[model samples]
Target: MADSESGGRPALARRLAAEAVGSMLLAALVVGSGIAAVQLSPDQVGLELVENAAATAAGLFAIILMVGPVSGAHFNPVVSLVDAAFGGLSWRDAAAYLPAQVAGCVAGAVLANLMFDRSAVSIASHHRASGAHLLAEVVATAGLILLIFALARSDRAERAPAAVGAYIGAAYWFTSSTSFANPAITVGRMFSDSFAGIAPASAPAFIAVQVVGGAVGYGLVRLFYPPTVAPGRLVSDPRRQADAPHPSRERSTLR
Candidate 1:
């Protein structure tokens, strides 16, 4: 069972707090570093992108390490949904996580702007809408989800921090949309006018594409790692001495 299940209210609260704080710090890092990069490399767009990506990748690794134990470190709503779908999280808690993630992201963007001495809630002017951009969002989000669950199913969950960070860093350069694969962060980016921000008008398409990507990723997971039993049913290897009978066998025996 998840820690939230066993520990109840206190655990849930702690997890929510971790998600909020972690998401806030992530947005701060993204926007602040983008601002700093632009100031430091004024005319060099590539150099600024390099600086921003590197900072974000490193910051993400650290944040996940710090918060993963608490909230599964899901700063992204799609990730929370996928986790719940896979039985790693309960739907009730997952429902709660979405609002927290979105709210935290918005607050984080405002805080980032304030820290950089800008208006706290300026609407982003960075227009990022195009057919290519929407396609990039889908690919970027799909790849992120696949990477995360692939690690989980393979029992390499411990490597997620480094792997996820690295993937995002690489995606920044490879994807046309600069890999804003996170829905919460995409919304957060709308509140800042820095290099990292996305225009408010462009956010809806990106978010919709991301949701589609998430569904595709989930379908891929089911295809590749088909579950051995129905939801809520346990299965154990018959080779193990303490194994319970298979559900079908148990039902037959009971009958």
Candidate 2:
């Protein structure tokens, strides 16, 4: 009853819609900001990065708040997959979220390019794959997964919006690849030849390490926040409230 009603097809449709739109907006913010950063801070690479990182961090926080209620605001494919693995989302729903997220990001890239008076679809020429960059992707993505699930499992999900935004902002400065921790965004960036763009050649390697990073994060979550050893019980245990969204409303956050 209640479970069926809450997670019924109609609800699924709404959630999918929310995921698509939220992801689109997220990509737009990231790519658009990168373009602005380059144009606004020409000849100052450091200043361009600062501007891009700041805008992305702030925009991510707001976007999560806007749609976290609807679809958990999982704008990233890795986040959606990991949430499914943790029993927060159904594998089926998680699977559906993949295409929506990727498509939304692709559309967003086009939108950003058009907004900047550029070609609608331009292949990025930026080649970012390097040994250190790959390693950094692993570190950045693993930390992201750990942060998100840590909040969910520890009943601190309410802080995810701000925390995720802050972490990504910091990562942009720390990670060599600017912490492109989201595969959907990584792909979305492939279509733009602007400041935020990643060459198509580099995307696969980045995405591969991101998956590895996701697995490592899963292990870390189990090690640090073991559900089997919960003193009271797992906060995100579906049996406790089957109809609840994986992280529930509070648990939902995006990067």
Candidate 3:
């Protein structure tokens, strides 16, 4: 059985809705918290980042738990692409998801700005372009993807929300670019001038490096968990009937 069939995949419209709404909420959390953090900790940059990271991590955990079932909660375009590449999602569905995620993120940024009494479409002035920044983006994105898929393959998908949230929180401090790790979020951040925003001039390089990181991460997944020669079989145990595949065989295949 296909993973979608066994797991009861929602309608495409429903899944798309979940993706959009989830992405919107995530962006709102990021931008709003950043704005609030800067205001609350005016002279303390470290305190501002701590507040922003805490809020973002908590928000991400909640959002993923809310929408993981519907659309795999892939607010990131590279994540959607990785799902498609690994056969957990179709290319057509991923294509639809990308635009929705991006649009929702953009809307969320605008909404956050409005809520904070700022212009809705102000391009960020915080320039974050540099070789070190681009390299940081690559490392951040690659680590994120690796962590997500690793948990998935290890039969720990249920732990993903917490793990992903924690990883992002840590990466925020460790990575030079504060781990934008997501192209949609990067673009959305371009519309805000708050603590979390990235300049328009910086978005492209960040996005490009993120994509490259995603590809490298996917390659690592393939390397570690090579495809099975037997397409639908979960195990090679002699006691188990080959004709009667495991219920989760298809889902496990992607792992």
| Model 1 per-residue lDDT tens digits across residues 219-250 | 88778766533221111111221244443422
Candidate 2: tens digits of C-alpha lDDT, residues 1-255:
232334332367776888899889988999999999999889899999999999999999998888776677788888888877776677898899999999999999999999999999999999999999999999999999999888876767668889889999999999998999989999999999999999999999999999989989989988998763221111222323344445433322222
Runs of candidate 1 with Cα error greater than 4 angstroms are 1-10, 228-255
- Pairs of colliding residues, candidate 3: none
lDDT tens digits, residue span 1-255, model 3: 233332345678877888899999999999999999989889899999999999999999999878776677889999888878876678998899999999889989999999999998888899998999999999999888888776666545667789889999999999989999999999989888888888898899999999999998888877876654322111121222243367544332221
Model 2: colliding residue pairs:
88-246
Off by over 4 Å in 2: 1-4, 7-10, 228-255
RMSD to true structure for each model, in Å: 6.9, 4.4, 5.2
Superposed by TM-score, candidate 1 places the C-alpha of residue 54 at a distance from the truth, in angstroms, of 0.5
- Which residue pairs of candidate 1 clash? none
| lDDT at 77, model 3 | 94
Q: Where does model 3 exceed 4 Å of error?
A: 1-7, 228-255
In order, candidate lDDTs are 0.79, 0.82, 0.81
